[model samples]
Target: AIAGWTPVLDVCVITGEDGPHTALVISAGGVVSDAVAPPGTPHLRPETITLLSALLIGDWAVADASPDGARIEARGIVAAYAQFHLERSIRSLGHIDRTE
Candidate 1:
């Protein structure tokens, strides 16, 4: 089975050197196995991804503390998407835990 402190697993879509690429992994803690992404997966910029990650863990204010209008829009989109998925995952896990 996969190991380590991965309470959350997220993907950052980036414009890599080799055209549009999806992040296989990022940040601290653990390895990724059997990583795969189909073609044309939607992706956000790295800055947006960072903001989204921070927001996911309830640090939205810190991310948005000082940013321009463009930055604000990007962060908002990424943050919204990230929060939805993360919360859904947490609820699913909680349900599984309770049922067990």
Candidate 2:
């Protein structure tokens, strides 16, 4: 995720019972090791990532602008919003050939 930030997803895992049981995974950790969403879950909304980036970085400008996760530099900010499905923005965080 972000250089020093992690992703956050409100997951509600439900199970069958007399009524119903649900487990919410609000925060896990870095995507490098944790999985927030399930394997069957899909990551299609970029807005979610944007809001997450804002919450994680406490920067509205950055978060509002990162709703797309386009540039490689923007992956961290995006992944910071996705806990289990952090792969979507991984490719964006590539090696930058800029030393200036």
Candidate 3:
């Protein structure tokens, strides 16, 4: 029932006081790595930023972003965990009408 555009909601993970928002994604090496792209884009620039966001949490701080991928303090599922939460959130938003 959480409606309205919540900026904080959009913020799936806030590592530090002011850090670039990020979500988790599978890397080319098949690792559940931090997002290469910033949040909310399609392909990589998806408007729906849940896939990555669902795995993040509040305490994790943005460690770095390199050719490898985004880095954070959190580990394993706790870090990669945001995906499930995001999936649910995206589902809650419901379906879009493509019948135009």
- Across 48-94, the per-residue lDDT of candidate 1 in tens digits comes to 54554565477878676634543654544534444454454333333
Of the candidates shown, which would achieve the greatest TM-score relative to the real structure? 1
Report each candidate's C-alpha RMSD, comma-separated, in the order given. Answer: 10.8, 12.4, 13.9
lDDT of candidates 1 onward, in order? 0.40, 0.40, 0.30
Residue 32's lDDT in candidate 2: 17
Summed backbone clashes in each candidate are 0, 2, 12
Instruction: Give me the displacement of residue 74 in model 3, in angstroms.
Output: 26
Question: What's the TM-score of every candidate structure?
Answer: 0.35, 0.26, 0.19
Which window of ten consecutive residues has the lowest lDDT sum in model 3?
63-72
* lDDT tens per residue, model 3, 1-100: 1332122324233232232343433321112214444454322222223323433332223222211222222323222333444543344223644232
